[model samples]
Target: MVLDFGFLKTEMMGEIDACCDHGMMIWVDDPWIASFLPFTSREASAEVMQQYRAEVRETGQKLIEGPFGKTLLLSQVPTAENLAKHWFRRLAPRVRLRSGNRADLLSVVVWETPNCMATYHAPDLGRSRPGLSPRHSHSEKFPNEIGGIAGEGGNLGSHERSTFSQRF
Candidate 1:
C-alpha cells in the first residue's frame, strides 16, 4: 500500500478540518506560518485576548492558548514558502532485484489513510521459528487494552458481572 500526499492538499481543506474536528493532536511542521503569543504575554488581558481572537478569525488562523502563560501553541497550514520548501525533486527507494542466484525477498508497505494507517508485510521467506510470529500472533492484553477493557464483556467490574452473566 502506498499513500500519496499530493492529492490531500487540493481538497477543500477537508482533511485538515476533519483532523481538527476530532480533537486530534495537530503539530504544524517547520515553515508553516503561525503566530504564537510570547511566553511573557500568553495570559493576555481579556481585552487583548478578544482582539487576538478577532484577528484570528479574520485571518483564518487557529489559536491554542491555555490559562497559563507557558502553555500556548499556534498552528496553521503553510502555503507559499513552506509548500515550496516541501517539494522534492525526486523520490526513489533502493530496492534489490533478484537477477541470478539471489533468493526471493519479502517486502513491506505502509499506507496512511484518513482514519488509520495500514501496514502490509510479506510472509516470511520459509524460515521457521520456535516462537509466535509477530505478523499472525496478537495478545488480547495489548497496551491499549488497559483495565481488561478489551473485547465485549471484558473486564467488567464486579457490580456489572451479574448483569453480564444473566445475558450469557
Candidate 2:
C-alpha cells in the first residue's frame, strides 16, 4: 500500500488532544492499486497510472505547502476522524472517475498514531457493509469503543492497527 501522510495545521488543540500535539498528520492509503498490481500493468493505461501517482503526490505537496505551513487554514476541527472523512470524500469520486468505477475504495483511515486511527467508509458506493469480514468483525467485538458515525464504524482497539483496508 502507498500510504500518503498529510500534515495539517489546526488551532483546536485544547478540545481533543490529538496524537500529534505538536503537529497533526493524516495517513491516506491506496490499497486498491497495491492489491491489483499484477492486473493493473495489463489492464490500466500508463497515462492513467501516471496521473494517479501525480495527483496523490500533488495532494500531499499542497497539504504540506498550504495547510502544514499555515498558509491555508482549514475551517474544520482537523481531527483524525474528520480528516479521514474529508480525504475520503475528496479522493473517492476522483478514484471512481479515473478508474472508470473499477476501483473499490473500502475505507480511508487517518492515523493519529500506529495504534490510533479513524476510518471513513463510502456508503453510496456499496462498499460499506456490516459483518463482511474479520476486519468488520473487530468493530462488533468493541462496539462501545468503536463508535458508529454516519454508517461508518470506528475501531479504537490498539491491536487493530491498520492505516486503511480493502475488501480483497
Candidate 3:
C-alpha cells in the first residue's frame, strides 16, 4: 500500500521497502502529530497514523493539505546546530495493524521546548555564516567594507595593511 498509492507509485518503492525492511524504529514522539497527540479517541485514530506513515514513506511523491505538508521534504534531519529555528507539529504515532501487513514499532516521547532546556540560554540573532553573520562578515571579507567615523580609522586601516594593487 505504501509503495503504490496515488502519485506515490514510482521510484519511492525502493525507499519505502528499505525503511520497512530495516531502519529499525530509532525514535517516535507526538507533541501534536506524533508526540503531542491528544488523549481523545479521535486523535488516536489508527487510520490517521497509517496515512501519516504512508506519506512519510512516500515523501516527495505524496501530496498533503496541511501546514508543514508543503515543506516536508526540505525539512527533516538537519546537519546544522540550528534546529530550534523551526517548528514541528506532531499528529499521530500509533496505528492499527491490518491483516497480512507488517506492524511498525515506534517509540513515543515528547519534545522539550528550547527555552526549557536551560536556565539562561542566550538569545542569538544568528550569524550569516559559520563564526560570522552579515553584520560581521564584512570585517573578515572586505575588512574595510564599511566606513568609520570622520577619522576613527576604517578603510584606512584596511588599506594600510595592504598595497593599492593588493586592495584591488
Enumerate clash totals for all models, in the order shown: 0, 0, 16
- After superposition, the stretches of candidate 3 with alpha carbons farther than 4 Å from their true spots are 1-35, 42-44, 60-168
List, residue by residue over 62-144, the lDDT tens digit for candidate 3: 22333322222223342122222211111011111221121111111112342322111112313211121223212234332
In candidate 2, what are the lDDT values of residues 17-89, reduced to their tens digit? 3323354333323333323232335346455545545654565311222223312112344677876665556
Tens-digit lDDT track of model 1 for 1-168:
121223223221332333233342222332321233333443554456566456644543344543322222223333322211211100001111111211111222111333432222223422521221333222233322101001112354422211100000
Candidate 1's C-alpha runs over 4 A off are 1-5, 9-43, 67-168
**Clash count (model 3, backbone only):** 16
Per TM-score, the best of the predicted structures is: 2
Each prediction's RMSD over C-alphas, in Å, is: 19.8, 17.1, 20.9
**Where is model 3 poorest over a 10-residue stretch in terms of lDDT?**
87-96
Q: Tell me the lDDT of model 1 at 74.
A: 24
TM-score of each model, paired residue for residue: 0.19, 0.37, 0.20
